[model samples]
Target: MKVHVHVSLKPGVLDPQGRAIHHALEGLGFIGVNDVRAGRLIELDVADDTSDAALDDMCRKLLANMVIENYRIEKVAA
Candidate 1:
C-alpha cells in the first residue's frame, strides 16, 4: 500500500520561506502573483493491512505540528 501526506502551515502563521520564494518570483518578472505558500509531500510504502487510524496517528505524532500546521492523508494502490 502507498500513503501520501501533505503538511502545510495553517492560516495566519508566519512563513518566512514562502515569503522569500514569493519575492524571488516577483524579481524574475512574474506578474499577478499575490501570495505563495509552501508545503511538503511525503510518500510512504506500508503493509497492505496498515489501518487508517495508524496513519493518522503517524501524522499527529511526527509528521505534522498540530499547533501551526495541518496534514491531509491519501491512500493509494501500489
Candidate 2:
C-alpha cells in the first residue's frame, strides 16, 4: 500500500517562505494570486497490513508537527 501525507501550517500561523513566494510571483507580473500557503507531501510504501491507526500515529510522531501543522493521510494503490 502507498501512504501519502500532506503537512501544512494551521491557519493564523506566520509563513515567511509562503509570503516570499507570493511576493516573487507579484514581481513576475502574476498579480492574480491573492494569497499563497506552502506545504509538504510525503509518499511512503508500506506493507499491505499497515493499519490506519499506525499511519495516523506516524503522522503525529514524525510526519507532521502537531503544534503548528496539520496532516492528512491518503491510501493509494501500490
Question: Each candidate's TM vs. the true structure?
Answer: 0.94, 0.95
Best by TM-score: 2
Steric overlap count per candidate? 0, 0
Q: lDDT by residue for model 1 over 1-78, one digit each (tens)?
A: 989999999999999999999999999999999999999999999999999999999999999999999999988767
CA lDDT, candidate 1, residue 25 = 100
lDDT of 2: 0.94
Question: How many backbone clashes are present in model 2?
Answer: 0
Q: Pick the candidate with the highest lDDT.
A: 1
lDDT of 2 by residue, 1-78 (tens): 888899999999999989999999999999689899999999999999999999999999999999999999989876
RMSD of each: 0.9, 0.8
TM-score quality measure for candidate 1: 0.94
lDDT of model 2, residue 16: 92
| Candidate 1 Cα outliers beyond 4 Å, as residue runs | none
